[model samples]
Target: MPTTASMTRRLAIALTSVVAIFWFVALGLGVYVMQDEFTEIFDSGVQETAERLLIIVANNEARDASGRPVEAAVLAPALNSQYLTYQVRDSNGMVLYADGAQEPFAVPLSAGFSQTATHRIYTAATTDGTLFVQVADALDHRSEALMEGGTALLLPLLLLIPGSIAAIIFVVRGTLSPVAQLRDEIHTKDGGNLAPIDESALPKELRAIARSVNSLLARLKSALEAEREFTSNSAHELRTPIAGALAQTQRLLSEVPPAFHQRTAQIERALLHLGRLAEKLLQMSRAEAGIGISDERADLLPVLMVVVQDLERSPLGASRLNVKVEDGTALERSVRADAFAIVLRNLIENALIHSPPQSPVDVHIDINGIRVTNDSALIEPDVLVNLTKRFTRGPTEASGSGLGLAIVKRLVEQMHGQLLIASPARGMTQGFEVEIRL
Candidate 1:
């Protein structure tokens, strides 16, 4: 398949070819028109020369072959135009009298003072009924004149064709310069770069093409990033399980008493890690698939309260995490969101996992949004940026599959809400916060 750039260039060239072909045909027609004009001039001049010769022959009192009178001149200056070469012919095809030449030219049959030769020939009867003819070399003159005229006509065209082609090349290349720039940018794109190309001021013909190419680049960039994250997450999440399985196998082989007991425990723990990995993979797939989450008018305060209550029922609930609910001074308490239960469950679960043990996880909820900030050191700045990225985990202080916050972010976005996290004093006090729209 032809690439977009190559296809566009070929189209441009084809258009130019069409124009050049029409122009060439037009030039040829012009040459033909000029040839006709030359022929007309030649014919008219020959006829006039023959007519003058007829008058000259009729006026003369000279006698011809049988005592009939015939007129003859030694090529008068007025008739010595060279193109109008004249000859006097008898009734037979014989050149009896000739001018402007020592030898006779072709004396074709000229009857009743009419044209016969390619050059115009006039024949007339003298007073004695003797035959006389006057003719000129009009065809020779027309041929020479046309050839001379064409040097001016065809020569310029010879130069024009190449110059026109050169101009088209320059114009097309200049017009497509933006596309060239876009191609170069695409060639140099990194897996993470998905930014759109700036194609403002491009001609309308190419604007659509540029937009389509940019869109394709954006999709490819997204796919590559998703693949990288998926691979990284798989390797990172499986590490623990693989290690546990290996340790159990070693213990079963080395230890003598109660080996089966410890081995079973290790295998169970490894199975648990595998189960979490499977869930995380499923969630990642859902996020990547862009499944539309149904929207509903959800009350922020009650939904968050239920989420906090559920988390309190979990192991972290025994740790006594502080969950607070705040509200905005707005008339509307309800906003469109995905399933309230799923949203709250992901947020609360993420908070419990990230918050330090014995440190209170503050689940601050409000009408506009909810902020789940916990007492913990913030992860590195880059890590915080990558928090919403699939398979990214929080600081090593917390044991997590790293997909909890990413799932929360995806869920919130699906609900048309935003998620933001910040930790001031390097996660010392203020901790990380996730603010979602109501």
Candidate 2:
């Protein structure tokens, strides 16, 4: 994409070129108009000079004894700018008087404004025989004067064109600086920060744009606040009843007979599933509120230990968990502590409930990320595609709330991380794996 500065400069140059071309065309038209007027004025001067000389030669007082006038001399001037030379001829084609040695035309031309190869001839009759006064002006002389006039008209514009382009560039750059600053400020904002953009110092055109952005930010903040409040209130409200039901079920388990024991245990599992679902709803609210978007980072080892201990106290503790971290790696590395702890608990708990008793779920922390693999999970490929979606559970018979991986995915995104799930996990012959990259 073209940038602001480059586009501005290109437009300036195009306009300048157009203006320059227009001026050049105007100058050419001016020169063409002057060309006809110049020829008329020069030819008039030649005719006037010829008429005066012809009168002098044709006057009766100037006639000599044989009715032929005596010859007279006309000298060439020193300046020689548009030098004019003339010759007079009698009726019988005899030269009466002449100035300069060369003749303008070899054969006699007719009367009144005759043009030869190089001269303008005037043939007149004045109470005697015919007389020709021919005056010739050099063609090169008129051409040189016209060239000098055209040069004087066009010289100054050469120096001004570059400076005009430079001024346009400087002005355009200054004009767009505010827009660039506004874009940078808006680009840095995320779900964690929805503050209004500054508009006090902006140009009038951009002030409206900033105002619109601030209005949008206001609406988004309100919506997120409402969502967080409802989730928190709902979690708190549901926890009370679900806890009461679980407590009643545990107490009833001791008093029940062997046949009733199985049914009571099923009731207890349903209550626990309801409790976990309520907890996951609260976690979703935290993710939306940017609680996991902290800059301070902590180690992964402590959070992993806590999550593993949490699973050990659950019904799925019958299975073994094997954790392996490469030496000198993943121990000192910083992780998003509170957010990742929740993610770890959800992942390991899901693996624990799905796996058979005495089977091991392996968790290995590497330099780049952490991977959890469970060989006991055997799900279809089509179902694996939607496993990260909300309210999705494994195919196993063990009861689940189905919000574990959903909450984990939401929190990971809040922390600017990635959660990838696959059945028949990478580098494994057969298993399910969840890879969390932060």
Candidate 3:
């Protein structure tokens, strides 16, 4: 079977994916904005350095030309490596002085900012425009700063995404827990259990569903009760008339002429079959009424013994039944005595009727459950599957109402037990078996 997708998992995954995508988009936008800001700040620094250097270089050159002493501190070379490199050039574009520059920048000397592939350049000049100072900031330094800023913003997401996923799953599972509970409660409703769901604890959205389900269950329970009552009453009303009719037919068989005896016997047989069918209907009604479950536990061994003994007294059961009880076996269970007896009677009677003449019906009892087996041709798989259905029978000439297994199956389920029907019973090659586990 294919696996089903969970609502909680699907919701969590969708939510997490959306959150991650938006987070990535926001991070990209943030990085873009930060890059622009960094460029502006670097440009300002480059322009400021060019203007300052132009003042100092122009003042020193004027002092040198006037033969006046220039302040050494103002013209001192930078002791540390600077991010900005500069070249001082005269109007003819000849280099006068340079700081942190291996070679003059390959660009025109003009005032204002310009950019080359490698650097951001800003130029400043004296009042006469006789000299110019061009400041160059390496492009790689700005790129490195932007990369570090982006990394700082991105690293937290590694932890945040997984943590968010975990939190999302947790919240999704919690939010859907009520739905799971409602499903379980609805699943418990059946013929044997039609109890209404408690709507008090449910959310507003699901309370309407619970109320609708409860209404349906109420109608169903009423209909089933009416059906069971009619079957039970009709069966009870039929038993006396059927028995009387069978007795009268048997008397008529004795009184009738030899030529009429065959027809009278046929009538007797028909009445007998009708009586058995009525009894089965009664049993089915009781099973449908959910009489198998009991609050009080009882020793089921005595009930089992009584049913087997009663069946043993019958001519068909006499000398054709074998009973085996495991040592130290205990049948203390919560199933009602009458219901358990009906189940046992049906299974044993079914086995006895279907088995060939002189074939022994074996009944095995243990702590776990009970098993009934009988010698017969192996039942077909398709036919075996439908054996517990009402009026369904196998390919057999034996007389049966076909409600025995159906009744037993109903009672077993009401008792919260499992009934398994199998061909080639256990280790035997040609037999049928009914095993019940309670």
RMSD of each: 13.4, 7.0, 3.9
lDDT tens digits by residue: candidate 1, 285-402: 6554443243224345555566667677777665566765554533133232223455566666676676667667666555566666666665678877888776777666655677
Per-residue lDDT tens digits for candidate 3, residues 1-438, read: 999989977887888788888889989999999999998998888888788888888878989999998774554453123577788899998887777775777888878988889988999988798999998899999999999998998888888878888998899889988999999999877765677899999999999999999999999889877877886688778998998899899999999999999999999889989899889989987887777877568899999999899988998898888999999999998778888999999999999999998789999999889999999998899999999999999989999899999999999988889999999899998799999999
Candidate 2 segments exceeding 4 Å error: 1-175, 195-226, 256-266, 285-292, 295-305, 315-319, 325-337, 377-383, 392-395
User: Would you give me the overall lDDT of model 2?
Assistant: 0.73
The stretch of ten residues in a row with the least summed lDDT in candidate 2 is 73-82
Clash count of each predicted structure: 3, 0, 0
Q: Weakest 10 consecutive residues, lDDT, candidate 3?
A: 72-81
Query: Could you tell me how far off, in angstroms, the CA of residue 334 lies in candidate 2 after the best superposition?
Result: 11
Residue 7 miss distance in model 2 (angstroms): 7.6
Candidate 2 versus the native: TM-score? 0.63
**Tens-digit per-residue lDDT, 1-438, candidate 2:** 975656677867986788788878877887776777777887787777766666666553356546774554332331133466665666666665556645445645445566556544455444555666666666666676678767766775686578668877788778889988898978856665677898998999999999999999899878866876787688788898899989999999999898999999999988887787678878866665665554345677878888887777776754478888888775433335666787888888788777776678889887767899887656788898888888787687877767788888887787677888888877776678999887
In order, the Cα lDDT scores of the candidates are 0.62, 0.73, 0.88
Off by over 4 Å in 3: 1-4, 67-82, 99-108, 198-215, 277-306, 318-339, 356-360, 376-396, 406-416, 421-431
Q: Which residue pairs show backbone clashes in model 2?
A: none
Better structure of 1 and 3 per lDDT? 3
